[model samples]
Target: MSFRRVIIGLLCLAGLAVVLDFGAAAYSEYRVSRLLRDGSDLGADPEVTFHGFPFVAQALDGQFRDIDIRARAVRPDIPGEILVEAGLIGVHAPLGDLVDGNVRKVPVDEVHALMRIEPVELGRLFKIPDLQVFGPPADKSDGSGGSGGTGVTTSGPIILTGTVSLTSDTNPVPGTSDSGKPVSVLADLRLDADGQIQIVATDIYYGDEATPAAMVPEVNRELVLAKFTRTIDTRDLPFGVRPMKVEASGGQIVVEGVGKNVTIDLDRLQQP
Candidate 1:
């Protein structure tokens, strides 16, 4: 072939390659938006959006937008498997997938709200936001939430070990002196497949207090501590069922992770 003809052919191929690349990216973006929108519809809510992505979703009943989340590696006084960042948003969700008989949902907004509060929020204080969960919510009957037999998988048994250095935004108590030092909190958390969470240790240091201090004083200090560790066990309990019983004594914390005791009523999902 003539040199000129060969050159012209090569240029045509390059142009086609460019078009294909852009086409592939557009397709990927379309697929992601569709999946997110489908998730929102299943949850019975508005829309879902993640930063530059155009689609919006109802993480729960709450609304969120311009969310930019990511996982990264860094060094300093921090150690983490990932770090997530987002613009102004409301109610992201805790990290477990929900499994209820034939139904499963993420409750992303619920998780977000939980993450914003105490103990859970402590992970962010360290700049190491390793807390994350993957996979779509699966049904317990389909048999995919956790291991084979226990029957609870919406909230798997998750164990989190981390250190938190936190400075509260709350005003100082009327009678207490301010140390002006960030407190260090050591935490170990567990959540069963049935959506129950148990907290083993959430030890914190505040001035002279040796044991962990209560985030809320109106609550029984011991119970408050136990609740953070215990109530999580009920987080994924049937939305209407009473939580499994508990007995607390001494300083030790014990809990039964969600098991066959939990039941899911998929019939509640009615179409309007």
Candidate 2:
């Protein structure tokens, strides 16, 4: 056989090997996605992406460096839909066990995740059906939103009513006899000791986003702030994502979490 022919055969074999590796990785990703969706009770299959090529090597070695996942509607049993973007780091799962469909426990060195909290969650927690979170006031001098001008932190917007009215009605404005007093939620999102989102509204400006008005009545000041100032329970989440930082982004609240040296027990993904 010619030397060139031998070289060509070797090249073909290498190409086939690469194709097979990708196929295997794709299959594994599909299987893991299904498990995550059903086990976590997510609305649909979570997007799973394995890091690095030659995934077969990682599987044979039984250690995965990183795996990214984006899941919509996680923890359906919990109030409000939860969206999740997570990364699994240093996972340990043998290929044989996984192939046999007997794989159960998936231990990871760390799991970093971002949980996007939609308006519905805040509405239920804040007792406002139409709660709106917005970016800092366009005019910094207006003080409609909070970012301290540096723009690192953010706050939610409040169209106040209910006890906020104080005059009579206890429902959100527009429903109250008086028109809805537009209040921007200048709240600082913090995680309480219990891992709950503790929103402390530092102040509220009564006006639309474009226009900034005087602060509400001092007596009504604390009253209006009180409606948004409270620790909300969100401990019940899929994949055991623990809250780290809660911030307002693009008119929404997103809480980032990280779990270190975590073990995923597929049987009790929810544990509820």
Candidate 3:
């Protein structure tokens, strides 16, 4: 064969290889979406992206360097829905399973995820209408330095405001004559040692009028405690990541965490 012909043939082969590699990557994405949706009860199809070129080579090695999946409106039998984004590292998948068209399990070395829960959904979970929660700069108390220089120091505190129902028999609100009267209050958001969310009413208000906690009655305080305290379960998050931190920003709650050495099955994820 002529040398020029040989060169042309090699170029064609390289082009074909590139096309095949792209197809393989596309197939991998589809398979991952199906696996997560069918096995994990994900609310919607997750967007999966495979990192690195030549996915076929990664498949042969039975490991992927990086994979990302983003899911929206994920409702995992939890009280509220959240948007979840996960980055998986060192994912292992068997070539044999891929050939058989049955991807049973995938194990990952590490998984990092971020979950965003909107304020509206949180309000619904709390049974409060039109709830607004945010972290505002705390009041800066006047201070004096050792040299007698006056200054101010700032603190951070999370505040939550909502109309709380007073008619509930279990925990009735005090100072309300009518059953359906809604009371507005500014509550403090705190996390307990066990990672549970606790809402404590620091001040109560009635149409811009401040109500003293003493005059609110003891039963009303108990009502506030009972109505606002909630425990968030973090054991079984998406991709098995445990929630480590929670923050309020832009009227939403952002929870972020990481998982180590987790195994997932496509079939099990589909179960309720």
TM-score of each: 0.30, 0.73, 0.66
Residue 46's C-alpha lDDT in candidate 1?
18
- Tens-digit per-residue lDDT, 219-256, candidate 2: 56666677767666656444677676777764456777
Winner by lDDT: 2
lDDT of 1 at 72: 25
lDDT of each: 0.30, 0.65, 0.61
Candidate 3, position 132, lDDT: 59
- Which segments of model 3 are wrong by more than 4 Å? 1-20, 72-80, 95-103, 138-156, 168-196, 199-227, 267-272
Clashes of each: 19, 4, 5
- lDDT score, candidate 3, position 101: 51
* TM-score-better candidate, 1 vs 3: 3
Best by TM-score: 2
Worst 10 residues of 3 by lDDT: 146-155
RMSD, model 1, all Cα superposed? 17.1
The TM-score that candidate 3 achieves is 0.66
Local lDDT at 77 for model 3: 43
lDDT per residue as tens, model 1, 37-156: 243233322122344322222323233343322212121222322121112243233211111112333222211111112222324432324322111122367655533221212233
What C-alpha lDDT, on a 0 to 100 scale, does residue 114 get in candidate 2?
76
